[model samples]
Target: MTTLLCDADGTLFPSEEPAYAASAEVTNRFLAELGAERPFAPEELQAMTNGKNFRAAAQELARGYGRDLAGADLDAWVGQEKDVVTAHLRTVLRPDAAVRDPLRTLAGRFGLAAVTSSASSRLAACLEVTDLADLFDAARRFSAEDSLPVPTSKPDPAVYAFAGRELGVTPDEAVAVEDSINGALSAVAAGFPTIGTVQFVPGDDREARAEALREAGAAVVVSSWAEVVELLT
Candidate 1:
């Protein structure tokens, strides 16, 4: 592959669980405002919307209640969610050599870009905390929320397509590393040979997660970044 489209949240770092912890607060607030009957616990929300952005998750939740979210209201909540999650992640995330070391090695052989459904600020904090920011240029860090003409979230291939055009690479020329079913679906939809990694998934869930990702069109599912390194390098 000529390029590597890396997913940031659960793929590049173990930010999902903690990020969700913070997001639940904001999400609960939104749910209350929407007049939804109940608040979702952090894990419940993660299970419901692991690979999607706040906007997408909000729409899905609202739909279940027959509540159509106004565009402006959704947009505002999305921003609020990002701010809260980013702040929480920055405080909780720490550098991990397991993640940084392999990507550092892989960087020599491939063009790298972070392509995610996260807002730009959230992606930036992830890269920064993991000491991975230097590996990709700001121009190479593509966010569905910040980079698209029409903002969207994974399970939607728009961001991946946008990255391909800007980077001048076809799916045949690049591979994607994603940790969520929706994320794998996004890359596969864009025609990339996707590698679904479950390194960040909880230990008890890894095997089941692998199976789910495989069903989502991943060429293979790996347990760690080292396996990813061995396959591509």
Candidate 2:
């Protein structure tokens, strides 16, 4: 493949937990505003919404709580969550030699792009904090939330398709590196050869998570960036 479409969040860095932890307050407030049964604790919320974005996760839980999200001020909630979570992520994200070294090698060999379901600003923050910003240019960073006209989440291939068109390539010409089932589904559905990794998943859950990614149409699943580099190079 000529281009490497790398997913952020769980794939690039372990930002899922802390990002979700940051979202807890806003999510709980959203739940209460919707008159749901009770507020969700940070860990509980993270466990429940593991790989989803705020809008998707909130709506899914709202259904369980007998609330309709149709007319909710979703923009407001999304904005608030982004504000809190981005700030929290900046404090927690750090450079990891494990991912950075392999990624640096890969960047020299392929066109590296940041493809994520996060807002572009948040993606920038994560990349910056994790010492990965230089590998991807601002033009190469595409976000499903901020880059797409409709702002949809993963498992919807609009963002990937859009990236291909913008980058002058087709799906088959690119390799997708994703860490979650939905993320894998998105890339595969868009016709990219996907490599799924559970590197950021907890030790006990990695195997099961890898299986899920395989089922989602990832060509193969890996546990670390070293394996990723080995396969690509």
Candidate 3:
């Protein structure tokens, strides 16, 4: 049977606006508590945080605040920020139930799995919040604790291979739905029929990233989960 592997963050949930806002607020407050001034806006901080790990993003933000923070200080900042972000995320994350129905329908015809860069806990929270937890037959959620020999993450294809292995399917026998460039590239690189779902269409740059994914060998680019379901059907 064909398996449909899906991404979680931008694919299942929004771009984490409320979480970013909370993180920024906590960051500013933390800086003030340390007798420092805020350096970046929430939006700017959000951009810096994207596609990066907690420590990396935290250290980057600290540098912007004119502090050479690393080690425990960076870790502490990230921990505090995470607590604030998680609280806010629990409220503001909106899942597309429209997509969930289609996923359920597809599950009857094809195996379904969630393959995401997020830690299992966060992914589970997202699935629970979206009421999509029951739709997936399996999930290959990655975390820092996973001790794979290779640095396997999105855009590397190892994560997709791992998911396919767990689902008892080959990459070519599966379809992948992804929102980010890295996620799409990972699926394509793994030889899956990858579809790029454009969650954010920023002006003319819409086609740019999509075309880049296409050039990297994605099967198609779509704007919605409906389109992905249509292709699978």
- The residue pairs found clashing in candidate 3 are none
Q: Per-residue CA lDDT of candidate 2, range 1-233, in tens?
A: 78999999899999988888888888888888778677778888877766567877766877887876754477778888988999999999999999999999998899999888888889999999999999989999998888987777787888889998899888767999999888898899899999999889989989899999999999999999999999999
After aligning candidate 3 to the native by TM-score, how far in Å is the CA of 143 from where it should be? Answer: 4.3
User: Best by TM-score, which number?
Assistant: 1
Q: Any runs in candidate 3 off by more than 4 Å, and if so which?
A: 25-38, 46-49, 52-81, 137-153, 200-205
The number of clashing residue pairs in each candidate reads 0, 0, 0
* Residues 149-180 of candidate 1: C-alpha lDDT, one tens digit per residue: 98899999999999999999998899999999
Candidate 3, residues 1-233: lDDT per residue as tens digits? 37788877767667455556777777677657556654557777655554343454555556766777766665577667656666666777666766777777788788777876554556666777778878754344443213244333466677777777767788668888877666777777778888887655455656786787688677788877777778788
Give the Cα error of residue 173 in candidate 2, in Å.
Answer: 1.1
Model 2 ranges with Cα > 4 A deviation: 63-72
lDDT ranking from best candidate downward: 1, 2, 3
- Candidate 1 Cα errors over 4 Å, as ranges: none
TM-score, one value per model: 0.97, 0.94, 0.74
